[model samples]
Structure formats: C-alpha cells, structure tokens
Target: MVMGFREFCDYEWFSFTMENYVVHILFSKSEPGPLLEGKSKYVELGGVYSAQLHQAHTSVGQTHIHVYARNNQLFAMNHDGSAHDRSHGSQIPNKVAQAITQKFPNFTLPKDNYIESAPSGIVNAFGHQLLLG
Candidate 1:
C-alpha cells in the first residue's frame, strides 16, 4: 500500500520507510464495528486484522483486533484492559508470533518489548494482571 509522508511521534518525520513497516495493529472493544465485521477493507488494506484475535474477553471487554503486516512484528493499539487481561495466558500472543515467524522468517522486531496503551481501567501491564488505574 502507498502512504503519503507525514509527521509521526515527536521527531520522526517520514515520507516512506521500509524499516517502519507494520505487521499488525491490534484493537480492542472501542474499535469501529464495521471494520471488525468485515464491512470495510480499512483494516485489511495495509495490514491483516483479526476480530477474534483473542479467545477470551475481560470483564470490561470489547472487540479485539489484531493487525498483521509483512513481517513477524505486530503491535496493539486501541485495546481495552479487560479484554487484554483476559487473553493473557491463552497462548494467543506466542501463537500469533509463531505464525508470523513461520511465514516471514526475515521479519525483525523493532523493540525488545512490545508496547500497548493502558486499557481504560488499567494503569500497568503485569504478569497476567492489569492494575486498574
């Protein structure tokens, strides 16, 4: 997909970057419903997405979306806490990563740790525990 150059983050202004390719952008409950329902090609246009990326839902959950791109790398955005909290030990993350690696062996992770926004009711991501903010 072709994307126009724009200012991203604080100091990164990029027109096009091969190194900045996104494998996926996972979403939670608050995502636009049509995109999750496959009514639109927005999610699939530039990357792959899964509405059922996770098998379980948290107490305060909404729909979860996963965006997968050309590489094994993936990211989570717009996800709520309860949904992510419930899916913690479901082998989803590792499984997803494995699948991506199987297909894109050359894909590299941009960071040693994955970054996800705090959920609506969470302030931190703990081991199988998301503390409410």
Candidate 2:
C-alpha cells in the first residue's frame, strides 16, 4: 500500500527504496490528505535494530532528524544537542503537533537517537518498529 501528503502541508515527508518505495510521512489528524508529496531523498532506515543511530546533536542550527523509542512509543524530532531538546513542542507549530500526534503512533522528543541528514535539510524522521535492547 502507498500513501501521500499535501505539497504545502506542515508535516514533512521522506522516502527510501528497497524492493519498493516507502515514504515516511509526518501528519496531523485535522488535515485530511488525498496524498502527500514526499521527498526524493535516499535514506537507509534500519530494520534490524534502532541502537545503531547516534550523532552529534549539539547544535540546534545544525540540521538533522532524530528517531527513537521511549516508554514503547516512537518519536521523531528535529535538530539536537541543543538547549531546546527538553521542551516538547517548543519548535513545532500548533497545527503540526496536533496533526502528527494524532496521525501517527510516533510522537515526542528524542535524544541520541538514530540521526540522519543528507545534503538537503533534515526534516522527516523514520524509526524501526521492532525495538532491540
């Protein structure tokens, strides 16, 4: 199955390819989507484990996407190693928080999680469903 997002939607979307293309979409519940226009970037989100992700999150201005699980809940957050890491919903807009929080099972801030940032700005985040300790 495939999904889509709006071009101007507040939520960010990402794509990765293996046998088929899968898009990681961040969305809100209030806004219905026919489909979201996702990113054309190549990323390798691990399926085996989540511990492999760790990065330099010290600079807020530095662009990066972080994905991790805590209390059995999946989360994706932007920028890291900054003072703002503690404040949930500090950076995200009201509409964005509501959309993603309701749309996806993943939500909340992350730290020292699997981080990714290509040549382009890092926005959307992906996490492996199976947790491995």
Candidate 3:
C-alpha cells in the first residue's frame, strides 16, 4: 500500500526495496510524484537516531523546507531546493519557532523571539534558547 502527496498531483507508484538486512524502505514515490520534486533528494538526518529521508528544504535565504522527525527535535538536511548547498544562505529561519513551540511545551521565550544569549548573528538554530546546566 502507498500514499501520495495531494499537492503534486503526479501519477506515480511507490516501490519498496530491501537493500540489506538493516534498511526498510517505506512511504516512497518516484520523481515528479508527490513530495519528490523541486530540489528534493535523499538525505540522512543526524541526531540521537539517524534516519535517511527525502526532504525538500532551502539552501539559503529565507525559504527552506525541513525534514524533521515526527518530534521535530532532529535535523535531516537543508537543501534550499537547489542542486548545491551554496545556492542560498545556510541558516535556519525564524519561523521554526512555531514548530518547536508545538513540540516542547516547556519552551519559553522572552520579549524577543530570537536567541538572546547567542552571538549577534548566531541563533539557537532550532529556535528558543538552550539553557546551560
């Protein structure tokens, strides 16, 4: 069984293959299909547990697509939807505040939305301040 992204409206069938004993391919579609177009490619998101995925995200500037985990605590990759990572600025957008706030209820922000303790240009990356222990 396969599901498609309604946004693309492309007709394509998903295929699942087991390369080795360690990988399981699920919820996949071909090119021009839903969620596979527009500067999208397979990437490995790094964090507590690594997961390979196809995510659409910006490489620079203000626009980006993040392939975050269901919990939104880990980062998969940022492509800027381009062939190269330099096509756009390499920084997480401020809009991520909304996503983080939804995930971590303990998250709190002062008057400013940006990371206050971070350096001038540096931010928390995922939004909100990281309290030091």
Q: Which one is best on lDDT?
A: 1
Taking all chains together, the TM-score of candidate 3 against the true structure is: 0.20
* Residue 69, model 2, lDDT: 31
Clash count list over all predictions: 8, 12, 8
lDDT by residue (tens digit), candidate 2, 1-133: 5454444434555444446666575544344553422332322233321211223232223333333232221333533422223333234334433443453333333333222222112233222321221
Rank by TM-score, highest first: 1, 3, 2
lDDT of each residue in 1-133, candidate 3, tens digit only: 3233333232433343355433322333333333444444423333322223343322222322334444442332222222123322333334444443443334343224432333333343533444442
lDDT of candidate 1 over 1-133, digit per residue (tens): 4355444332222243366673333333433322334332322322353322432233444444444444332443223422243233222345444543454344332222243344433433353464343
Candidate 3 yields a Cα-based lDDT of 0.34
TM-score of each: 0.24, 0.20, 0.20
Of the candidates numbered 1 and 2, which has the greater lDDT value?
1
> Quick one: RMSD of model 3?
14.6
Identify the runs in model 3 with alpha carbons over 4 angstroms from their true place. Answer: 1-92, 118-133
